[model samples]
Target: MSKISNFFKGGSSSSKSKHHRSRGTPSPQEAIHKLRETEEMLTKKQDYLEKRIEQELATAKKHGTKNKRAALAALKRKKRLEQQLTQIDGTLSTIEFQREALENSHTNTEVMKNMGYAAKAMKQVHENMDIDKIEDMMQDITEQQDVAQEISEAISRPFGETYDEDELMAELEELEQEALDEGMMSMGGLPSVPSGNLPSLRPGQRATTRRKVEEDDDMRMLASWGT
Candidate 1:
């Protein structure tokens, strides 16, 4: 375990960290790259240890009773390798968590910066505008619209001719009354009907109609004229 730690964070690591401190800090991208490299290295070590454990287990199985000492040694080595692999897994997990947090923080920082820039741009644009001026422009447009509507109404209305609706309706009623009187005079000039009491007859009608009597009289007059 100590050897693995020393291999990753040797004397050169201390010098590199000091240089980074002097040069400001490492970017999240660079940090993530280093973490991924470490993860890869640890994963390869895990594979090697797994293979050695399998070989040790095989050796233990093969020498069940005959070569117990050698088999025990192999199993002890395998146990140590397993413990180292477990520690590496824990370290890798910690590194991955830190890398992810740094990545998220970096993304948030860029987003905030872009939002700040947009806000500044909006402020600059609005600096040239006035709310009072906008209201005045809207008022002018409304007055123009009213003037246009008045002009349109004037163009569509008649120029010189205007009639009083009450007077026209009264004249029309007088013409209608004159027509009704003419119809009544024509009807009254017709011969008056014999309004005397009628002869006794059935409920629905007389035995011979008044039209039939007139027809008989006309026939007798024609015969007398021939004679």
Candidate 2:
């Protein structure tokens, strides 16, 4: 019975010694590793929160919400989620803002492309400008003006008669010739020709011959000798 009690006591003390030995102090490296692991976990949570906040901001900007209040209100019960994310910012009311650039870089490119397309579409329209119709209208107006001129010319002249260009020129030439002939006739009287005959002498002629005998002695001697 004594041996059994001693054996039971030794067993208890050994178990207590084993427990004490198992509770040995941790190394500095182990404590540092645990601290780093906790820090990494916290860093991961911060990163997740930051990404979520950025996503929310992007959504708000895309919809063009009026104000933060409106955006917060739009979150509804999700506001709790946002609060959880922003709560760790520690006493600072300021928020981080990163501007998002416009995604549509080529603004005028669309307008220019459409303009080119419209120009190509209108090519046929520009080519078919109804030039023949315009020309026909112009010809009609010219013909009407010519008819009006003809009517005016007819009214200015004698009625029921029309003169052609050649006929008018001929008539003018004839009138001019007639005026020249009339002018010449008024300048000089008519011309006459002489007849081929001589007139006979009378008593005045015989007296003239007798006065010729008294005119010269040569003439009277020639007359008595009769040669």
Candidate 3:
């Protein structure tokens, strides 16, 4: 045992005795054997309990249970025990797995190395056995998993991809053309003039306001009258 401890801890020969000491935690091989034993024990207990329940039900039906409520209570108790037995069966299965690994490791040094890893895993399991911590971890994992799933789902969609430069430029041109067309239509095919209600001329053309044109007409009439 000291040798095994020293093997793992890199401890010195003098400290080997303390290092190799077992905490009575079952080795993988031992755990597997115990799992088998537990499996058989739970199976037997379950069968017995089932038989007892059946007997009680039959007797109650035949003799007419004085109190239906009492019979119901007994039924619930049996169900609770059955559930516990089911949990035990599951635990036994895990033990069996440990046992098989232990057996494999005994023949293969690699497997044995992994067995120490399994022991560490078991230690972590024990440490996190608290309901609240376990629940919190589970919730955190669930939330992260959900977020990842959502992102995956979104990215898989056709719309998830970004438009390339060429595509963006083409779209921009189309929008600009549409706006220009709308502006032309709104202007009744002519460009918008200033608020003075005068004809807006091109850069080389002369601009004439209605008031200025009317004043020119008045000056012409006065010249004709003088002539």
Candidate 4:
């Protein structure tokens, strides 16, 4: 009796130690994976139970009225399998809800962690920066841009153009008059020679004819002007 009691105490202590040394809690990702696997297993089991229920139902119908005992037994088995299928359905629903919750929580955790990391990096980047220096840099850039724009406008401006408009117009008119005079001297108020042939007239006769034509032209011009 003493040995048996000691053995029982030893077994209890060993079981307690085992329970205490159980595995740590799984991460969200692992938990979700485990839940999905369990769901799959339960789903397969549900399918098997459904198949068995159908088989039992068929057996019961086939044995109806001919073997009442066998039919009753088949029906009883089908009912039990149906109940098991129902239980599995409920379990699957619970596991699915839990998995979804865990997945959402994990996503939120990762997002928050990344956001915190980015914020830290940004803080570090600006840790040594001065707002006053930043403002001064911006102001200097604006001033340089203004100076550059002024220089560009100065370079593009027209130069060496201080002549008076009235004087330029008078000079232009004088030049035009000189050109007209040169043109008139070149013409010498002579009639154009005929391209086909010259007139076959005596020299003094031609000179006399020309003087008479000129007088007639002058008289016609005076008449037109008076009209």
Candidate 5:
């Protein structure tokens, strides 16, 4: 019974160790490095095998029509080498495919990680923002701007000049009447000429005589009117 218990304990410990090891798998970069090493080894082997195949082919040709048995042996060796080269080619192709797949997977993982970070940043940016609050803020800003514009227009308006329409019209009519009276007085002060005496007067004296005669006639007419 003691021995059985000890065995079971050992088995459990071993299983736990194995689980830990399984969890600690090689990273993708390490795996790709190992795959590339393998690819290089296979490529070298393929080159060697191809060289061997060529050597055998040359040997076979050299022995042809001379020694049938020797030529047949060389051809058989070439065929075997070619087979090995084909297997190496297949192995290299598999290794390259695995390496490329690992690289693509690594790139995709990084891309997904960056996208997750971006999503987190965007979430943080929107965390404190409420749609209703934003709308209210915008409305307040618009109202303030409208008030400022009204104030600015008020400040810019013309100031201090005012007049009554009736007063201005009356003053304009008074000035026009004064101008007309002055014009009529100026016309009345000008001299007049006598009708029949104007032809007998000398040209130089006509203007002077005309003025004197006009004054005399005005005075006579005034005296007769008084009588």
Candidate 6:
């Protein structure tokens, strides 16, 4: 009975472990983060290996003529470090490729999700609309706009005298002719002033004398017209 109970307990534990594993699976972003971390670790390892390789090379050079065995040992160690560095390089490359691919896939998934939402929104917007109904509504709107414009124009129309263009032009010409005739008649009715009637004076008094003669001439002209 104890053996059977142990077997059942083991089975239940296995099932729980599987459930936990399923739940604990990392998302793509988390996986990418892990890959980046791994890449960074490998890069640091590569750098360390390269520095060691350089150190080995320097040691080999230093011991070249002095001790053949030491020089040979240094070269061997350098070779091993180089091989490890090469492996790290390959691993880093693979991790980087995987990270980039995952990032691209995640971006594509988000884009597709957003596009789906946009399509759904457009579908909803067009759900209650048809091409024929839309055209009819647009036509009704245009007609209403035209009606409104005509009503506005009617309301703003001049309520005062309305004259034909030709008649207004003829009347304007008659009024202009009357003004011109009045001006000419008034100018012609003024008596002519004798140029010799201006008093001879010095240069300094010339301006004052000219002004006085103009005033007198104007008075005489007006009196003669009145007579």
TM-score of 6: 0.61
**Comparing 1 and 2 by lDDT, which wins?**
1
Task: For candidate 2, give the lDDT of residue 138.
Answer: 97
Ranked candidates (lDDT, high to low): 4, 6, 5, 1, 3, 2
lDDT of 1 by residue, 83-198 (tens): 98899889989988988998899899999999999999999999999999999999999999999999999899988879999999999999999998899798987876789986
Q: What is the overall TM-score of model 5 with all chains considered together? A: 0.61
RMSD of each: 8.4, 29.7, 26.4, 8.8, 8.3, 11.6
Q: Candidate 5's residue-wise lDDT over 157-225, tens digit each?
A: 889987999999999999999998898798996654556653566777989988999999999999999
Off by over 4 Å in 3: 1-31, 63-66, 110-227
Q: List, in order, the clash count of every candidate structure.
A: 0, 0, 2, 0, 0, 0
Residue pairs in collision within model 5: none
Please give the lDDT score at residue 30 for candidate 3: 64
| Model 3 poorest 10 in a row by lDDT | 202-211
Give the candidate number with the greatest lDDT: 4
Residue ranges of candidate 1 with Cα displaced over 4 Å: 1-24, 156-160, 164-166, 186-188, 191-227
> lDDT (0-100) at residue 6 of candidate 1?
91
Deviation in angstroms for 22 in model 1?
6.2
lDDT of 2 by residue, 1-227 (tens): 99999999999999999997997865544544554555456567767866776766666665555676756654543455567656644312221111111112233556788999999889968787788998999999999999999999978887675769898899999999999889878978566345656566799997897788677767778889995
Worst 10 residues of 5 by lDDT: 191-200
Least accurate 10 contiguous residues by lDDT in model 2: 94-103
Residue-wise lDDT of candidate 3 within 119-207, one digit each (tens)?
Answer: 99999989858889889999999999999999999888886557699989999999999998998998888756667876667644444
- Tens digits of per-residue lDDT for model 6, 135-211: 99999999999999999999999899887999989999999999988987989878767767666679879888789
Which is superior by lDDT, 4 or 5? 4
Deviation from native of the Cα of residue 115 in model 1, angstroms: 1.2
